[model samples]
Target: MSIRITGLRGENRIGDGHNHKGRKVTSAPSSIGFYLYGALLLLVCALKIPALVRRPRDTLLRAACLLLLSAGLLMILAAPHSIAGLNRHSGIANVSAPVVYVMTTIFSGASLLLIINWRPAPAEQTRRLTRLCLVLYGAASLAIVLLFWAGDAPVEQRTLFDVHYAGTPCIREMIVLYLGAQGAAMTAASVMCWRWSAKVRGSLRAGLTILAVAYLLIVCFVVMRLCAVAARWTGHDLDFLVDEVSVLLSAPAAVLGALGFALPLAGPRLAETVRAIRQLRQLGPLWRALKDVPTPGAVRVPLSWWRNPPAVLLTGRKTALYDAILALTPHCDPEVRDAAHAAALRAGCGDADAARAAEAAMILVARERQRASPLRPPDATGREVRHAQAQDLITLSRAVTSPLVHHIRDPYMPLQKAANHE
Candidate 1:
């Protein structure tokens, strides 16, 4: 058997084994298309299950996803000739195939319209278009049922193609009416989805942008198909070009649909990587400044300089120890906090004096947020609380690094630095 347009039978439209037998034995690559399309549809369904069950914040997005998956599955089912033949042949036939066809047409068309007529924020538009597509599908189903009752034959035999010219004017009118309504709805939906990409970030934005383009491509594909079909009726040469273009376009739409539908998973990871880089940059300069500060042992011969530096070097009344720890606190990771604490102590207090020195540092750190810099140590009572909080943060920080502490440098005098730094 040879392929025939629905309800149209012409000449053999076939000749040799190459045209008929070879083609018949191999069939088209519909199964492969079905597998890929079906897998994508199933994956989309899997993703939506959590959204549908939990009712995610983006409920409209979840619903659009479900609609797209259903449309894709309909297209996949339409791909196989055996399935198409079965739909045509099933007596007492269900209206499911035609209903699916109409639904798919409406969704694909509305998705493109939403893209082309995009606004600054597409959220409202997308929601409206989605609802419109749903409404159109519902209205089309109702019309199909009415047509079934008033038909010359069963619903299976009364396809839209047949209804287009069936002598009953109301049947033809309803088919045309519903098809127009479906197309208009799909176009609107596509435009909204395309516009909504503006709010997304990083890879999510990229995927949405690509999805917008893909949706537009699908719209263009359908428009081109309709134009070619019309031209063919009028005996034009554009039909072959339309078929070739559609085949080329369909691949990307399918691929992009699969990729876009996976964005919820892909987007967050991309955003995380970006955030990590920003955190590093925000802290990088401070770490670099710490690296360049001279060790106190290399320079300090005056015990009085340790007790009292020039106001210029000290930068007001705060000690260098106060300045160093304050700067390091925000960036100090578990691996580096001990080193930072040690550096703070060595720059001002020796290892033998670490506990006393740490108490002093704690006093200064407590006053850090209140004053522009550390001043004279807090009073004894304030010192007690300061020491406790500092010890807690540092102790917890050090415990976190205990297994890896061997790789860490102690303040200056190794053993005591290890013991008291905590």
Candidate 2:
């Protein structure tokens, strides 16, 4: 006996494992796609669950998390083999059909709730609309269960039992009810996300735009399923649309939806981490120069600094550099700074570099002066001294390592020592 599989455009008869429609039906790979998509959805749920637990007081976030988790669970159970197993274990003929239908309806409702709660809506209107959606989908689910019980069994046992029973008395109504709910939910989600995407910026905007596209795909999936069912009613077969095309739409839709939701929360954190690393690199020279002077309250080098720089270590380095600059303020001499500026200019340094070298030379001289006369009165010219800003620190850090500034620091020492020895 030949098995008849319907395509969107034609019917194909399969008897000797050959396709008459010039295309071979490959259901196995599609089955694997379903499993992979289901796993991805579950992984998203796993990652979000901890945040939900940590922020239990955030009602909106909690609601969205729970809805996403419910949708993921339903998707896992609604996979073809999984649903078939559920039907076999239940001992009810074709029971998985309505069970899967109900699950899909709930999943669609949950997706709608997630999007509604994720973006702000007026509290009173949102609450009322949420309640209405819950009631309507709840009624639809109950109606599907009742209709499944009342409908007669199909002649053929198929994985997509809904398509086979699409023309059955109560089953047809059940299909219409569930598909209508799903289509309406997806349409609303698409429109809302599209509108909101325009108002947001950066990662949030990208996420919203992606979410809108996912919803549009879901709408397409719902439309295809509805068309397949309608074909059954009109004595035509469009089983391929439901079986093949719908899965193609759904897998990406689910994956993209999960990623879209994640991007807004995770994107900012990733960007922050990257910025911190960049700042650490830029501040390295200033931090190293300050470390060499060993002022009081300077942070000790962490064992891991050379191997792997932690964020806390970077923060400590910044703080220590600032503190060291403040500690040296009392000993900064204006004469030393002026001499260093002239030396740097004679050495062909640019105006900015000369200024920076003068500041660096003054800081080095101040450290020496403070060491030589620990109890000296603070210089009147240095009374208004303040810690350098980050940019100034960076510039001074470069100057401190330059040959010109180093030569200026010990200009008379070599000549004076040689004359005394002579």
Candidate 3:
């Protein structure tokens, strides 16, 4: 068949099994791609659900869920089997084409809105931009559907729909329509992310940088397909562009885009978990030192976590330590604290270190007295509160092992220390 374009006539020689470069076309990978993509997105949705339920106004997570879901659905529908199924169900040839295009357009707009939300702006301006994106993409999606209805595509195409029907009238226009919308969104997101990356720091900057690269890769895919479609207009075949380059490019782009979106959200939580684990380990000595000081309803179990999350485990440990300390308040000796303070100062300790040493010394004495007395002490006074804050808990915990505190804890050390002070 000969397609006439630009006042010239040439053969439409685009083959079925192979591209212009004589390489085999493979789309089975995209079937696997959708399963993996969908599973990952579902995991993300699960993670966000708790946050969204707690705060119903979490627009960022909502936008991200929409973007990822649309992207996964688009991939699924792009598979040849899925296309065949849709065509069979709808009783329309190549019917999956418009639905896939509409999904891609929705993903494009959702991605742009997500990027816009990442960088804060005035609420009114953000809303206006969001509405504009939705309207523009909505019109394009509607046009794709209308053009599909208007176009003549009796032959169902599982793969290569764009290049396969490049010569057909309305299908040709529909191809350009969807690609144009995708290109515009990618270009806008790429520029916005590149500029935004330079102005931010840490995870946000890294996420934006990765997103910028992913957008460029997506643009490359679009451009390659557009070029092949344009080549068809001149009655030439460059089907290799779509079959080879564009399809290959899409895999990495999708992976990188998912990582880009994930980094900013998951990075902080990851860091906090690490910190909590580290602090919890450092507090082990202090926790064991209070083992004999009975905490009400405390069980003597192994330290290994049984499905306890890091943050929760750390909080519970801190609460238990404080409760044990409060139980020892009646045994606290002021003389022991005073001797530890003088010893710490004489040892060239700063005010903070001296205070921690004194507190540690008194805690050691109180714990020893509680252990030797054979009976439980009364609960703490009503007006008394926890003496240390969360941040100080680690330092105070380590101070239990300090030489100065142990020195002052000696029964005879306080008399000499008091005489020296006088």
Candidate 4:
């Protein structure tokens, strides 16, 4: 009987549906996980809407994210119905199948949009890798979509579709493609994040770490899904197992994807939280410093300074403690410069020829520096002028600067030397 054959197929599709259900008697836990993931997706969408409203420049990215969430939401709704044992009604079957199909299409569209719109960053090699990944995923999705559309049967009527609401071979392929794209995007974002995170201190770094972990989780799930698909295509008869495993994996992957995008937006909040926690432990040091405020301490610093060279000299708190960090122009030992030159040579440079070229380049830079409008010391008559200088020094000390010159400590011995001298 056809009924017997279909039942046998269904049984074979998931090993033992009854046993699977018995293993998890209630779907409540699964439902909760799905709900959480759905909520996260919606929240990300909600966050992006306002961002789009505020910055029109992000229209394309915002639109892509919105489309992604919408497609995911429809799939989530249809997933449970197909996973359940109930026979599809005329209305539900007709509408749900098309919805799933549309969801896959939307996924491909959104991914392509993201790829086409990606802006490259500094590292040309890394950017090329990223672009290549995006292109491969996009091309695969396009191939899958074309196959699905050109196939004899609608994807909904396929045996694979009966096993899960997800589109059959085509849908599975799309899932792999989408996941690959996301993994690549996440990697690229992580690379971009690294350069910026170093400039940030305290809680900001923690937030970035959390995001990186989330991105890694996303990549893991995507890889797992790819493995599952591969296993099925190899005629392993483990389609049921793959489907079940994929169901278990999808929600967490979705949760992590949402978290990765959301947490970075709250970086300032997390930073404040970290700062508050640190302040509690640092209260004693702070109280002591406040207690010693009237001690009239004098800190020694060099009289003349070049801002560029000295900025590199003092590593951490040395410049923080000293009010004015003097940058002495070309005053460092020639041996140190020579060592640096040697290092540069070892890093791919000719001997005297490269050194001469470097010297000529430095000379050109110095000559160009001659054209800069020199800062005139403010007239001390106005309080405003003095206040401006105070603010400027604070800004200079705290700012993140490029590394072109190295800073060195003044070797001259003073009458009183600090115990922590480097």
TM-score of each: 0.50, 0.76, 0.74, 0.43
Query: In terms of TM-score, how similar is model 2 to the real structure?
Result: 0.76
What is the C-alpha local distance difference test score of candidate 3? 0.74
What residue runs in model 4 are displaced by over 4 Å at the alpha carbon?
1-36, 47-51, 59-68, 71-75, 82-146, 152-234, 277-422
TM-score, predicted candidate 4 vs. hidden true structure: 0.43
Residue 62's lDDT within candidate 4 is: 60
> How accurate locally, in lDDT, is each candidate?
0.45, 0.68, 0.74, 0.40
| Tens-digit lDDT string for candidate 3 (67-104) | 76776566666655566678899998778778888888
Identify the superior model by TM-score, candidate 1 or candidate 4. Answer: 1
Residue-level lDDT tens digits of model 1 in 207-258: 6676766666665655654555455446554543332445466667767765
lDDT of 4 at 153: 36
Candidate number of the best lDDT = 3
Clashes of 3: 0
Error of 4 at 151 (Å): 2.5
